[model samples]
Target: MTTLAGKTVVVTGVSKGIGAAVAAAMVAAGARVIGHYGRDRAGAETAVAGAADGQATLISADFHDMAAVDAFWDDCRAAAGGRIDTLVNNAGIMRQTGGIPDPIEDWDAVWSETMTVNVHAPARLLRHAVRDWLDAGKGGSIIGIGSWAATRGTSNPRAIAYAASKAAITAATKTVARNYADRGILAYVIAPGVVRTQMSVDSAEAVGGEAAVTAGLPMGEWVPPEDIGALCAFLAEGRARHLTGSTIDLNGAAYIR
Candidate 1:
């Protein structure tokens, strides 16, 4: 049997990148996935179409808006037959700003948006999910998509807000795991290093050469988004409950801690 057979999963930011990959992987593993998107409705639909026949449902929500997040969950719960077994909070934005001097407006925009999507929305979603689990007397898994920047401070000042937001997510994951352990819910964070996403490629080009930046990695290659998705799938399947409350690093020896 598939590892996630009959499971119901909710994955945010499913329009593209890591979120899309995780949603697709879960559906392939026999889970019924609710693929959440913000504006990329076409991309979300493509992801669902690529899934194993009838394996996924698509929902749209502007995660930055609390009301939209609530409605997203409502639709997800209904699609999942009233039970959400796994949640993958993977929506995020990365603004690359060199250490060069910048106006306060730039800093404010990045910080505000990053915190809203990376920290606030996920926390609120977790709170609601925990309540639902308690009400239903069932357990579930929550996987937060974090970044290596959480541990390794960004060299660029423009990325400060992004790093801080992800760091907050890491701490939040631990808190949720600790408080909900006895209640039967598991929370874990996955911090990916330099993944070879479109964004990464663009950043590499903008910063000079991709090889020059990736040469620092022990693996000498950019990590794939699917790698993170696979790890998340394992966590959501409860295969390693003992590993709950942990931060699994996927940075290819970039940040060993």
Candidate 2:
């Protein structure tokens, strides 16, 4: 079992889905988690419950707003008493629009919203964390939640913007690892194919249906959110520092390189 004892971790979008699971997993691993939730306070509370040593705190911030992202980072650091050991950039969006056939107005709106929520917001927080880590001379870890769609183009053309945003972040994460490895900074990407989340369910409906999507997977089942959470916790431990800069696929061999 991985233990994050005495570590302070920050997880964005902790209200539900992958973010919630990551937060819960880290807490159970004995890390003090500072979770960010957009609107669902109750859900965030539930996710952090039963934390090892009961040291979990929740903050609220709308990812679409750049200024709010900065505030969230500052507040998270304050809650962690000016030290954050790990940051899990797990908040994102996949709009059902932005396809080639979409109306111009709809396409533009979907692309804008998806980029803001999925890329800009998380990147902003990462920037802040990296700067703080450098200033303190205490290197940290970053675990970005990317998707297999980032490398393997999505079959649903409507998700073009979503895939693009994920690719951008994945590149940024690898760049960080490359530049900061000597300084003790670690970064990794968890690229899941079809996670069992409401987002995946919606995407499945857009392509065909959940049954069809599942049948096409080699494992014949969607990846569980808990599995991703476990991976996040292990990465957060930063035990295998040599694994930094790697994008670990959690898609059950659906899109292997």
Candidate 3:
């Protein structure tokens, strides 16, 4: 039982999927959440809805726009009353895009966009949180929502960029954990396999079918998004602080590296 009473957290991509689940779990754990979304206010609203403590606030932002990212952070700071204790960098985009044999321009566009939102956006938020925590003389946690691709490369050539981006964050997260552990700044990466999200369903369908994807996993089923959320809450607890800079795998025994 992780208790986060009075703690404030900012969760990205809360419009749906894992982000939404994470927000709900955080609220259940008694943490205030500043949920970020783009064009899905209804989804974000539901994510923060029914909180036991009434601490979930929704903010909108487009990751494609860097200025929007900055503005979103400003809004989060205000909403959180400058007391952000944890950042769940959960917002991400997985593109079933141009493959190795695709046109050069097609590959370039997908690669660039994937890197921008998946890597650059989260990296920016992590930097901001670190700076603010340093100035306030407080310790904080950064949870990176990476993928199993960050470790075992994906078979989908179309998602090459996605795997590469996740890999980048995994390494960057380890670096942050090494450098800031002394400062009580903990960083971790939750690398999950096929989660039960629309995005994962689509990706599975692209390969063949859900059954095919499931049979590949040792668990023979897709992972629930809340599992990641539960881990987020667990990691946020004081007891798990010593596991900083670790990459927690949630792939259901698919790849045991």
Highest TM-score scorer = 2
Which regions of candidate 2 are displaced past 4 Å?
Answer: 52-54
TM-score, prediction 2: 0.98
**Displacement of the residue 72 alpha carbon in candidate 2, Å:** 0.6
Tell me each candidate's TM-score: 0.94, 0.98, 0.97
lDDT by residue for model 2 (31-112), tens: 9999999899999998998775549989999999999998888898889999999999999988888799999999999999
Residue pairs in candidate 1 whose N, alpha carbon or C atoms collide under 3 angstroms: none
Per-residue lDDT tens digits of candidate 3, residues 77-186? Answer: 99988888999999888888767988989899999999889988888888889989889888999999999987888877778898999998778878889998888899
Best by lDDT: 2
Q: For residues 1-257, what per-residue lDDT tens digits would candidate 1 score against the true structure?
A: 33898888999988888887888788778788888898899988866676776678888888789888888888888898899998898988777752237677777777888888889898888888888998998899889999888988764455778889999988988898999888899999998888878766755664556887787778889999889888888888887887889989898888886
Local distance difference test, candidate 2: 0.92
RMSD of each: 1.8, 1.0, 1.1
Candidate 1's displacement at residue 75, Å, is 1.3
Model 3, runs deviating above 4 Å: 52-54
